[model samples]
Target: MTTDALIPHATGRADDPQVRRRAARVAGIGYLAIFVLAIFANFVVRGSLVHPGDAVATAADVAASESLFRAGLAAFVVVFLVDVPIAWALYVLFRPAGRDRSLLAAWFRIVYTLMLGVAAVFMFLGLQLVTGGPGSGTMGPEAGMLMFEAFDYAWLVGLVAFGVHLVLLGRLITASGLAPTWLGWALVVAGVAYGLDTMAVTLLPDYAAIADVMLLVVALPSVVAELSFTAWLLVTGWRRPRVAAETA
Candidate 1:
């Protein structure tokens, strides 16, 4: 490109509008895919009730019947992996050029996504070991519980990291003059909920069930918010990153 074309404008750098539009479209679709996977995860975990009166022999039975749980979880991992690139694309679309990115905001997203993978790894391992197949009798009920506990532990830590990531991302959106304050706040709130819900399992051993129920409640709202935000982005694209002057 010529020097004149490469020159920075008042908005910092003149990026291609079409590129930004495409990135926004991709991000919107990625978010929708992740959300659907999350719903699938819920379906997988909601297994049939094994009443105390029933002659249930092993945890393997429970695992076997609810294999959808494993499948859903695996699907989640794949969708999340796909989400990373879409997220990066969105960040690139809106991020300021000609600015020092020594402390790049994308780092937070990468860290959060990495933690998600870690949590998934632990959970997948636990699922694999717990699911009764050929070598099911090797591990007792207590052992099965231990595997679950370990997975929960890893997930708890990951949630904390993930929450921090969301907070940082929300802050970045607010500061970047891209997207609405409402969407930014929603992102931060969802992230905080992720951490808080996991806190029950991490710190308060007795409150695990309560935490799960709380998560279910908060998740509905978050999913709705994300869907709404994605729809908005797909329809209108970003409406000129919110700026103080625009508000004024």
Candidate 2:
């Protein structure tokens, strides 16, 4: 059977302009949720509670503000959940460009989501240790600190997979003419930045001193890539002159 024949004609939603537009809006909302929740969890809550190399102080802060810590963990869980529909919306939005590639990108994102779920478990365990839950007496603050660190490292490791997903998704956006060419290139650059930063932190012990500087340089572009895309999807929907072949 031909490739065109393989596609289900009965389900015309994929080709409908209105449907695609709605998907874009949903994707925009998903991206916004991710950005907001991540910042709140990482900077606001953890920033106040966690004190690197000072397990006792960190544990005490967490204990004092256990509610905030729990809230942050809940945010992380919500972020992972939001990712599921985001991936599907993206695949639906871009499947017209290339079904196989779009599917591949979705799988990469789903895997990253799963990795984050595992990381969240560590964060929850860290909270339990701080709250003096079962075995907390034997484990102590040091063990709690270790679990928090594990949570951080696990998220970093998951970013490697996220980088690959962005690269694939960027290519799809560029090829489909669904958004601006520059936006696609920005996503590609963001993917590269993510990979390079992860490697620098993992491979070079001395890289920590310069890590903040490096993050400043690369992080802005990465943020711009997703934020701009999200804003565009929410505000403008998609560019005109949709691919005739795909839309037809």
Candidate 3:
């Protein structure tokens, strides 16, 4: 919550539109990049390899596509590094709306990023086990899969924090006209969906019955709402995307 104290003069720059605008651009670019990298790492690489119940096949697939798995690990590494700047960018961009709220949002995102970093560590450990690296401890697919799954669950926890961040941003957007008001509402919905899905996965012993539906619940709003916000930030430039008077 005391994030303003952590960053030098962040509060001092809150009223500066130039600073916020620049941060918005940086945030837009960072978001787009993170979006691409996360999709590749989560879907293209691990999605194709990590079988939920079949450790042996998962191992076989990863062993066959060792380089691809390694690339996924590398992508996660880059993601961890990039998330810090993006968090700062978001904080700086949104600070003008509400200093304490923006600071809290940034800290939430930073917490999420810490979880992501931990997830990446699990991913690296999984990779080392699979590839027989120094971190390997005679572990096979069972251990490897566990590490990979740990990565996933840790990432899930991060998403929970991300949901909170989105909710705060939604309020900021509605308050400040930084983006469309409808987009703020959509972000709130998306953020709630994220938290709901995380809770369902965490609390329910059997999630298969609701997993597909929950996936849609989370994915659609995120793709539409979050992407729309990012696009606005990219195109808005020095002009307001939506007039302040038009905000509801």
* Model 3: CA > 4 A from native: 1-12, 238-248
Give the TM-score (vs. native) of candidate 3. 0.89
Clashes of 2: 0
lDDT of 3 at 238: 40
Steric clashes per prediction: 1, 0, 0
Model 1: per-residue Cα lDDT at residue 171? 68
Q: State every prediction's TM-score relative to the real structure.
A: 0.70, 0.88, 0.89
Model 2 Cα lDDT, one tens digit per residue, 1-248: 46333222325566677667656766787889999999999899988899988999999999999999999999999999999878887887787888899899999999889989999999999888877897677787899999999988888788888888999989988888877888888888888788788788899889879879878857887889988888887774444545765797
Give the Å error, residue 2, model 2: 37
Per-residue lDDT of candidate 3, residues 1-248 (tens digit): 26432232454567666566667777777778988998999899989988988888988888889999889878888888888888888888887788789989889889999999999999888877766778687778788889988998998999999999999989999989877899998998888888999899899999988989999999999999889988877775345635563783
Clashing pairs in 1: 177-241
- Please say which candidate is ahead in lDDT: 1 or 2: 2
User: In lDDT terms, how accurate is model 1?
Assistant: 0.59
Error of 1 at 41 (Å): 2.1
lDDT of 2: 0.84
